[model samples]
Target: MAFFDDLSHIGFSTKDFYKSTELYEKLGFELIDQEDNLGSKVNFYQINDLILEVYEDKTNSENGAINHFAIATDEIDKTFAHVKKLGFELIDDKIMHLPFFEHGISYFNFYGPNHETIEVCQKNKE
Candidate 1:
């Protein structure tokens, strides 16, 4: 089945939230949303259909980088099944909603063979 319909957003782990926010802003992205997540600040930016989500790295470690990207899907159940059939390891098989957004978003993450985190999600129609 065709699972992912489009690229939703890219997630990034950064040492400085405001600094990273400024960088993306310099690149022509505007801040669209922000929320507290896991003791870190989650910032979402947008430039048309392209989006970037940056969250502070709690450990402030050297691992700060592009963490993951979420793909928009209409059929969450079928996507999960197909991703599993392809042998990707599920991180959490549960659908999660973002409290920051007024509209609903249901998604789950799975790790590729190389451990790259990817998300398949059903986001509200705009």
Candidate 2:
């Protein structure tokens, strides 16, 4: 079986999250999800199967650099355990949850060999 289902989304940390999201909207990306918590705001826009996650980060001066990329999984818990068994370092202590998509999503991140962030996530089914 495949470890991941598909490419979920690409995330960007920007100094002006609203501006970036607005630009994407004007380009025909439809806003699909948004959330605000812990003083951080994130917005998701989709064009077909491609999703773009934009979040505010005043400290991030680089406006367009990719913060991370996510791979979708149907079994996030099993995937988390398997990745740890393979000795991949976990970025989060445990799986994290977000009120995203329909029923929400569970996710976690690990650092690649080059220090790039890669997230594995599963969108819950209602």
Candidate 3:
């Protein structure tokens, strides 16, 4: 049996959809579509296979319970460099090889707009 199919998407909250869209676009995300009727402050973005949702709700705190999200890339350095060029804050200067489950992975974390942490990881080959 297949343990899992794949990650379809992850939802994240934001105070302003337009601002969040701008931030994500700077970080290499493309604006796919949005629902203006849903509310004045709700929208979504599609970055490759990832679907990021941003919602505007003053009642909800912007702390974002979801601390971080990650993307797997074959060219980690190139991807990291592109992100840096976009002016996003790199949290750690050094990449780390973390041992998890039955294998090890190399990754680095960075801060995105809205104080959200984003991780880029490359899995080690056996």
Candidate 4:
């Protein structure tokens, strides 16, 4: 059996592509490309190696199992500052320290477009 390597990309359905793109951009993602098919729209953003695909859908229901997604960063503070400057309110003003994780690692949550909770974290250097 071939073992899986890693997650290469993730897709999120949104009603507003412009709003979603703006929110992702504030989090350090850059708009890579977009596609339009039969009146449906899809936008793609790249943050380092990770690719985020946002699809504009009108029939998507509000209730979903997944609360949000996360993106790892080396410079959490700088990323947080960028998000703050874009007018996004952090869920907590303090950084969360997890004993289970590596030392110096910190994380905080913020709401994205449509109030989607996004967890941004930094891992300690070895």
lDDT of 1 by residue, 1-126 (tens): 999997887776776666666555653568999899867899998877978778877565544454566666788777777776765568987766774455777788876323446677787554
On a 0 to 1 TM-score scale, where does candidate 3 land against the true structure?
A: 0.80
Model 2 TM-score, 2 decimals = 0.50
Specify the poorest-scoring 10-residue window by lDDT in model 3. 56-65
TM-score of each: 0.48, 0.50, 0.80, 0.82
How far residue 57's Cα lies from its native spot in candidate 4, in Å, is 1.2
Higher TM-score: candidate 2 or 4?
Answer: 4
lDDT of 2 by residue, 1-126 (tens): 779996788877767666666556654569999998579899988877888777777786552466566767898998788777767657997999999998999999986433347688899996
- Candidate 1 has its poorest 10 consecutive residues by lDDT at 58-67
Looking at candidate 2, the ten consecutive residues that score lowest on lDDT are 60-69
lDDT of 3 at 29: 75
In candidate 4, what are the lDDT values of residues 1-126, reduced to their tens digit? 879887777877787668887777766689899899678898888888888778887787772124777789888788777777778868867667665555667788887776667788787775
For all candidates, what are the clash counts? 0, 0, 0, 0
Residue pairs with backbone atoms closer than 3 Å in model 2 (clashes): none
Clashing pairs in 3: none
